[model samples]
Target: MAGGNFMGRVVSYVVNELLVNTLANSPAFQRFAVRTSKRIEDASNLAARKRQELQEQLNDSLRKFEDMSQKKH
Candidate 1:
């Protein structure tokens, strides 16, 4: 049983090494990684802007409500 477990680990290690080397050596993979990273950054920025806009709108609405309430009293 111990021997079988050792052999399984050895196979897994070799496969992992091969995959790592292939990805490191491939230009296409490098470009894909860069593009994906850029897209994630862009999406993050867009979300932040949208969040700010929503917060501003909410603040404006609250101010208007407070002004109307004060005028009534």
Candidate 2:
């Protein structure tokens, strides 16, 4: 009984590995990978744009503050 159980476990492992390998090579998985990559790229671009906008706003505020201080002197 113990030997049979060991053999069954080996077969199961082999079958699972084969299935994983097959799925990885399939067209559907490739398409999914492409779509995920595109989404990440888009999110990164949007974050960069927002960061730049915030920096510009901060610089403008600092300039206004400096101008106000000069006027007091």
Candidate 3:
């Protein structure tokens, strides 16, 4: 029947895609991708911490300058 053929093609397509995806995400591929992602996350966190430290330093300097200006006046 036409319905049976349609169902068979659909099932075939689904199984093929699943197999291809599984191969693509095998252990070696997964390990490299996961490691790369973790490195990127670590880099981002380091940059964020550095930015916060810089901002704190700037704010402290501004406060000291403001106090010095008030003393002069």
Best lDDT goes to which candidate?
1
Assess every candidate by TM-score: 0.87, 0.68, 0.64
Of candidates 3 and 1, the better by lDDT: 1
Ranking by TM-score: 1, 2, 3
Candidate 1 regions with alpha-carbon error over 4 angstroms: none
| lDDT (Cα atoms) of all candidates against the true structure | 1.00, 0.98, 0.96
For model 1, residues 1-73, the per-residue Cα lDDT tens digits are: 9999999999999999999999999999999999999999999999999999999999999999999999999
The reply for model 2, stretches above 4 Å from the true place, is: 1-20
lDDT ranking from best candidate downward = 1, 2, 3
Q: Which ten residues in a row have the lowest lDDT in candidate 1?
A: 24-33
Tens digit of per-residue lDDT, candidate 3, span 1-73: 9999999999999999999899787998789889999999999999999999999999999999999999999
List clashing residue pairs in candidate 1. none
lDDT-best of 2 and 3: 2
Q: Compose the digit string of candidate 2's lDDT tens values, residues 9-73.
A: 99999999999999899999889989999999999999999999999999999999999999999
Which stretches of model 3 miss by more than 4 angstroms? 1-23
